[model samples]
Every structure is written in C-alpha cells, then in structure tokens.
Target: MHRIIFATGNEGKMKEIRMILKDLDCQVLSMKEAGIEADIVEDGTTFEENAIIKAKAIMELSGNIVLADDSGLEVDAMDKAPGVYSARFMGEDTSYDIKNNYILEQLKGLPEEKRSARFVSVIACAFPDGRIFTTRGVFEGFIGDKISGENGFGYDPIFWVPEFGCTSAELPPEVKNAVSHRGKALGSMKEKLKEML
Candidate 1:
C-alpha cells in the first residue's frame, strides 16, 4: 500500500484523520511517526495557504505524498476572530478549557442568532511529482453559551450544531466525522487520492 504522511502533531486531529482515511488503499502516518520534526512557519493569511505550506514542507523533507490541514473555528460575533489562529488563540500553550470559556465570556449576553459561527478546514496535498491541490470544507452552526461535550477537541465543545441539537464534541465520533469540516475536506481529498491511486 502507498504511504501518505500527514503533517500534524495534534493527537485529536490525528485521530480524526486516521478514522476518516482508514478505508483508503494507503497507510496514513503522522509527522512524528515518520520521524519528521520541523518548525514550519505558517504565516499565510488564509487557511488554504497554511495547509499548502505545511504539506510542501513535509513533502520536501520526506519526498513522499504529504497531506496537511489547517482548520479553525470562526465566531461571527467576534468578526470571525480566532479563525486561522484557532490553535494559537489566547496563546499557544493555553488550555482549551480556558480558551473555550474565554470565548463564551466574550460573547456573554449575545442572542442565539448573534452567536452564529462555523468551522473551516482546508486540506492540501503535495505529491513527489510536484503536484499540489487543495480542498476546503465548512461546518455552519452556532456558538453555545457554555462550553460542553467531551468527544471533540478545541472549539468543538462550544460549537453548537442545531441539526443535532448539541455541540460538535457531544456527537459520536462517527457522527462528528460525517459532518465535520475536516471530515468534509478529507472526504474530498479521499476522492482525489482514489483517482490517483
């Protein structure tokens, strides 16, 4: 089977990526598992650019197919703040608990309609032959007044999915994966890979 390296260090994202790509005719390995460690700067002003940057950096180092994703929560109330900086919001080392609560506090007293938000994900793939492509996915929902759920990481606990009437974190892995931004992006990537594979 072909081996594809995914450039990411977050355990949460790794789990989701592995789950989503499990059926592919390829082995998905994280950067750590591939013994790759580099401080690739993601200075892109957009998610697509960041994902591409990461994928290219890892592909150059490993000379293999590489996939990378840049995803984040965009709260409309905050003018889509913490969009690309979702991981680094409130500082890179801050706990998600603190970050989640801080967002709730900032949007305190806001009406439900005013709390609309969405999760965005951009997946970039780099091939050894110098081909690169990108796909984007978005999950629309509201921001819960309080942090809740345990099934997800980052802003999942506060991302209200009205269709499910719960936060993204509360949904089962299978359900979340079916509807998540990253899931959608990966699904698109999977089709692309299938054609190439």
Candidate 2:
C-alpha cells in the first residue's frame, strides 16, 4: 500500500478521510505518527495557500507525499469572516463551544435567508519533488437559529443544508461524506491520484 502523511491531528477528520479513501491501496498517517512535529506556519490569506504551506512542510519533513486540508465556515452575512482563521476565531485558546456561541451571538436577530453561508475546503497535495496539487470544494448552506446536532466537529452543527433537510451535524457519516466540502475536494483529486500514482 502507498503510504502518505496527512498533515492534521484531528482524529475525526482523519477517520473521515480514511473512510472516504478506503477502497484505495493507501495508508494515511498523521504528522505525529510520522515522528515529526514541525510547526507549519499557516499565515496565508487564503485556504489554498494555507493548505499548500501545511502540505509542503509535512512533505519536506517526512520526504513523502503529504495531503493537507484547510477548511472553514464562510458566513456571507459576516462578510465571509473566520475564513482562514476558523480555528482561532474566538481566540487562540478558545474552545469550539465558545467559538460557536460567539458566532451565534454575533448573528443574533438575523433571519434565516440573510444567514446564508458555506463551508469551503481546500486540499493541497505536496510531493517530495516540490510538485503541488490543489483542489477546492464548497458546501452552500445557512446558519441555523441554534446549534442542532452533536455528530460533527467545527461549525457543522450551525450549518443548515436545505436539500438535506438538516444541519451537517445531523446527517449520518455516509451522507455527510457524500456532500461535504472535504469530500468534494477529495473527489476532485481522485482521478488525479490515479493518474499520478
């Protein structure tokens, strides 16, 4: 099996990627598992740049193919805020709940139509030879009145999908995978992986 380092420590995301790529003859190992703790500076202004920064850092460290994703919620009403700074929205040390509450409070009194938003994911694949491939995906939805489910991470609970008739957190794993931003971005890379590898 081909082994690649996935530049993330989130177990949930790792699990989701693994499940999505289950049919492939590949293994996804985390940065920690690869015996490297390089602090990749993601000071980019865009998701694509941030993802490329992470993927390149990990690839250089491990000398293997590296895949990194930079994703976040883009609220239209908030002028697409918390875009690249999704993780550090409320503060560097703030928890997810705090971040969610902060957004909810900021969005108070906004109608459902005006609360439209989308999740954007950019995936960067960096090879040791300095080649980079990037793909982007977006899942359009709106912010719900309140946090609705407990199954997803990040801003999933507040992202309402009208077509799915629920928030991203309310959907099952398979269903979410089928329509998630990460899934769409990864799907874009599927053919590229086959052709390159």
Candidate 3:
C-alpha cells in the first residue's frame, strides 16, 4: 500500500487522521511508524505558514508525501488572540485546564454572543517533487464560561458549537471527526488525496 507520512508526534492527532483516511487505499503513518522523528519549530505567524513549515521539513527528510497541520482557536473577543499560539497559550508545559481557565477569565462577564470564537485548521500536504497543496477549515462557535465534557483535547471542552448545543468535547468521536475543523479540512482534501495516491 502507498504510505502517507503524517508528521505529528501527538497520538490523538495521528489517530484522528488515520480514522479519517481508513477507507482510502493508502495508509497513513505517524512519524514513529515511518521511523522518522523531528522536532520542528512552529514559529510561523499563521496556521498555513506553520503547517507548511512542518510539512516541508518532514518531506525533505523522508522524501515522501507528508501532511502537516496547524490549528488553533481564534476568539473574536480576544482580538483573535492565541491564533497561532493556541498550543502554547499558557506556555508549552501548561495544562489545558489552566489554559482553558485563562481563556475563560479573559472573556468573563461577556454574553454568549460576545464569546464568539472559531477553531481554524490549516493542512499542508508536501510532495517530494517540490509540490504542495494547502487547505483550510473553520469551525464557528462560542467559548463557554467553563469547561464541559470528557472528550477531545485542547480547547474542545470550552468550544461551544451553537449548532450542536454542546461543546466539541461532548460530541462522540465519529460526530466530532465529521464536524471538527481538522475533519472538514481532511474531508475537503480527501478527493485530492485520492487523486494523488
């Protein structure tokens, strides 16, 4: 089977990507699976840039088609803060509980409408032939006053989807994968992947 290198160390992200592509003829392999390890510096100012930086680095090293993504929560009330900094909003080692609480405090006393936010995902697929395809997905919603649900990672607990009437964390894996920012981007890129594979 054709191998698609997914350049991420996060197992949660790797699992989600694999689940998304389970039906494809190709196989998605994590960095470890591919016997490649990288410590990429995600210093880009935007999601697309960071994704590209990561994708290119891995592709250059492995000489394979590599997919890399950078996603984050963009809160309108916070002037779109923590956009590219979502992973390290409260420092890299800080727990999500602390980070989530910090974000909640920033939007305290504000109504739901004022707490509008969105999760943005940018995916970069880099080929060894110096070719790249990039796609973006946005999940619109609001940030709740406190965390909820036991599912998902990062800001999922506080991300309230008005359409679902629940936080992303409250949704089942299948449901979340079908509607998440990463899911949308991966879905959009599915056909492209099929074509490329």
* TM-score, predicted candidate 1 vs. hidden true structure: 0.99
- Against the reference, the lDDT scores of all candidates come to 0.95, 0.88, 0.91
Q: Candidate 3 residues 45-162, lDDT tens each?
A: 8999999999999999998889999999999999998899999887999999999999999999998899999999999999899999999999999999789988788899999988
TM-score of each: 0.99, 0.97, 0.97
Residue 16 error for model 1, in Å?
0.9
Model 2 stretches astray by more than 4 angstroms: none
Query: Over all chains combined, what TM-score does candidate 3 have?
Result: 0.97
Which residue segments of model 3 deviate by more than 4 Å? none
Every model's Cα RMSD, please?
Answer: 0.6, 1.0, 0.9
Per-residue lDDT of 105-166 in model 2, one digit per residue for the tens?
88999988999999999999998888999999999999887888977998899889999889
Q: Where is the poorest 10-residue window by lDDT in model 1?
A: 145-154
Sorted by TM-score (best first), the order is 1, 3, 2
lDDT of 1 by residue, 10-98 (tens): 88899999999999989899999999999999999999999999999999999999999999999998999999999889899999999
Estimate candidate 2's alpha-carbon lDDT, on a 0 to 1 scale: 0.88
Winner by TM-score between candidate 3 and candidate 1? 1
